[model samples]
Target: MSNDMLRSFFLGGFECSSHRRADGVRLDLLRTTTHDVLAGSDYRQLQNCGISTVRDGLRWHLIEVSPGQYDWSSFLPMLRGAAECQTEVIWDLCHYGWPDHLDIWSPEFVSSFSRFAAAAAELIRSETGRSGLYCPVNEMSFWAWAGGDSEKINPCATGRGAELKRQLVRAAIAATDEIRKVDPQARFITAEPLINVSGGSGDQAWQTEAENYRLSQFEATDLLTGCLEPELGGRIDNIDFIGLNFYPDNQWYLGGSTIPLGHHSYRPLSDMLVEAYERYRRPLVISETGAEGSAAPAWMHYVCSEVEDALRRGVPIKGICLYPVLDYPGWENDRTCEVGLLGTPGPGGERQVHHRLLDEMRRYGHLSDLARKAGSFADA
Candidate 1:
């Protein structure tokens, strides 16, 4: 791959959730904690390790409590700090939850979110000027699966079939449209998980189901980009770039030979990038790609190398992001996943594993070493 085409490394930032206290809110503190620590530890680690961009999601639910009321006190400072650190950010507006009052299917919810998105775009532009990226909604397919099909998040409506998918698409459209209105030049990287499924007869069925699940994500993007059949008045021109979030277990199966099989099983990140490129024909980014536990660094290496492979294959891959710079609490379970480059925080704010993955990232020279080795062999 040419040097001009190799995009910068993307590091994940903190993710906040509810569990508020009167002092402020739990999620807000979580963001603050990450900002402080990154400013101290992770920022230098990223710079020393050769990462140039940072990716973090700003929860709509946390920032906006009521319809018109806004709270920038907690989020703005973090963005400013990131900018000062010379790290570019891909701001994710909505991940999985909404403000306590907004219903996904409600007109009020749609209109309110549109206004919120526009306001956010304006603020980001006004604050950062022209050097800002936005992801109005993160993981549309995951949201559909969790809230609509799987009953995981708030307003957990499940088994609703296409209705749930439609709701997600509408929400994305509303958010994207409003953001574009505020900053017409705003670049967007819409992050959605790319789940690969495998197994036997039951596994095949599961894979089929998983593919359908995956379709919801691309479908929303396709609809937004005018690539799919118009489901909601042809509002498909809103998507600019594609952000793919893939995890190790994101590729799974539910039945038959409980043990999964196939080259798809633990797919190399290259294949995922190629899939997105083939489907969308636009610039693609690995928005949130990482593994859990001590394997995180090795996984980061493998995924980043795969990204280089895809670039060599002529895929218009834009960037690779190691999501969640700090190891925050997981939603699936309370245990710390330790997926970040800097290890998870220990009890009472102690750093446990220092530079566990970040050090490895430096050892490999940010995966550029691997890419050079591969290129040399290809030339030979």
Candidate 2:
């Protein structure tokens, strides 16, 4: 674990997705959470809580209105806000949304995306003089399953999971290549669902099926680094950092049952981190990890403890990002999901802090330093 890698040991993220639902209803999470309007204040709040690094997004569909045109009107202000607040951001170029004219499966899609990524990188470099940190396209495996196979979101095509995964991997690789051409010092983060699937029933056949599901989690990164798909224009250098998005329901039985984090059958998250490190030998980050309301503090405690355990075992964990640091409406139904350290915004744009989660964050910050101190003493 290195504090020098990011602006803060703990990072915060805003939910900035612009995905369209299966029924053609498009979502603008930034708008719902009011981050679009209050970027400066929101970032300022995070900084006050000791998090100067954040994850944010640019709505590609809104910006890339036409084939070759990009209107930075929507994203520029947020970038400026981050600069104003002295926040370091890992910008998500595409968070499950694209322009209407683009077909994700077509070759033109890859070309258009590459152009967009390069232009975006150049824009950031010119506007802020920062060597960019970006997740080119967020959660490829999750997107493929949720949108492509299950028909939950845009470009909803059923039974095309494998095809969609390949297309996304191709587009990401193309974007990475072009982005580097524009900004060679840029760092790329490949974030995908990190899950462990199992057969609650101990039948050998069901166990094998569960293993297959679990292994699919690595497809995106493997494809990016050319381990899975060498023909898809992947190269080893494409992998800079490994980002894993883990949550409560991440580990489950293939038959739709969950393995709660602390249950006897639940696998230790530190073990999962070790597995990932052994696979790629890359620096890791918990790109997204948070739970709603009262569960937030406990969930964060579990994650942070596992992170420390991973650190003790020599895993190069960069940092952990608390995703959606602002409360937002649920995607499926418009119910308020009481996630984030900050509550819903008020008339004057003030937010109430979740004292529980904040306490957990502070405690862990103290403990991380204590662990390091103890390790140094042991070495001495």
Candidate 3:
């Protein structure tokens, strides 16, 4: 089979609402029925678009309230519907929100999360009869960057305090381990934003900060891989797979007087993948990769070609996922709708993709196939 034949594409699920508020932010709580409609529509769209797998979010806060009180009424139907459609679901257990009642610093938080994970795993396995993929938490570093450092989300904290960071990591590890107990065959993908930062001349301090930011992505992965550096070992364990989330604007640089040779431009997504491959040699997946606005198609093709190139060179990349099938409402600065593959519906309700750009992607499918063949031949 060709490389393109072996390679698969996944789409991110969940188009829940999150609007900016006066005092803080408000998450438009998506009920089970609403999710069912969205998930069904997304699955059909993905199937028609040639995507094979779907990455869906299962928010912890939405299912369990206090402790053992579980609410499957909302998510169960959607799961069954996806299964019926023969779509592979990479279940994301916690995207960003926690039960509003649980404190990040409390032991109860960890215990509660563990219980939730085990129960969820059991339910999913029982219903699907497959060891479904699970991401106990999505983008741990990004969560810290937003909630802990930037104070953008709930329980927003600020400053250099390591407590919030530590707690989040702990919760993730606890949840991962608990889920493993219930479904020993479950696979994990620790998805984090592959942020690339740059700096200019006279910005030595900023350059150093940028380097630290890049290193932090690997740091979180290391924790999940159970190889945390001596200073960071109290938090995680080995992950089954490496889930990388990359975007066009995920790279930026600070202007300064003294610039390093490679410090001027953002590192390309290919370079980031090569770095991860060199470090772990695990089966990798671009869990989330897309562009905002009219560049969506071009961005998709660019990222897909990069992944194809990596495959040709023998990278163990398993999949590529376009995030959020629908143009979600209330994106950060209202940019969510623009990142979607299909342009946002207008007053007439028409959705379209740039045909020329999509044709470019189709052309490269052959290159992707060649790469897959190379990898297979090498393995043989």
Q: Pick the candidate with the highest lDDT.
A: 2
Please rank every candidate by TM-score, starting with the best: 2, 3, 1
Off by over 4 Å in 1: 1-7, 17-45, 199-217, 233-237, 254-266, 344-356, 363-380
Indicate the TM-score of model 3: 0.84
List the global CA lDDT of all models.
0.63, 0.87, 0.66
- Model 3 agreement with the true structure over 117-205: per-residue lDDT tens digits: 88988999999898867787777777776766777775577773356656666777787778888888777777888766665443678
Q: Which stretches of candidate 3 lie over 4 Å from their true place?
A: 1-7, 10-24, 29-35, 203-206, 229-237, 255-264, 332-336, 342-361, 367-380
lDDT of 3 at 196: 69
Question: Can you give the TM-score per candidate against the true fold?
Answer: 0.81, 0.95, 0.84
- Residue-level lDDT tens digits of model 2 in 1-380: 34327777788888987989988999999989888988998889888999999999999999998889989999999999999888999999999999989988899999999999999999999999977899999999999998889999988889998899899999999999999998998888887989988777678988888899899899888998999869998877886779999999898878788888777768899899989988998778899999987899999999999988877777777778898888889998989988898888889887888888999999888544543443333223
Among the numbered candidates, top TM-score falls to 2
Alpha-carbon runs more than 4 Å astray in model 2: 1-4, 366-380
Task: Give the TM-score (vs. native) of candidate 2.
Answer: 0.95
Model 3: lDDT of residue 322: 70
Residue 202 alpha-carbon offset, candidate 1, angstroms: 5.8
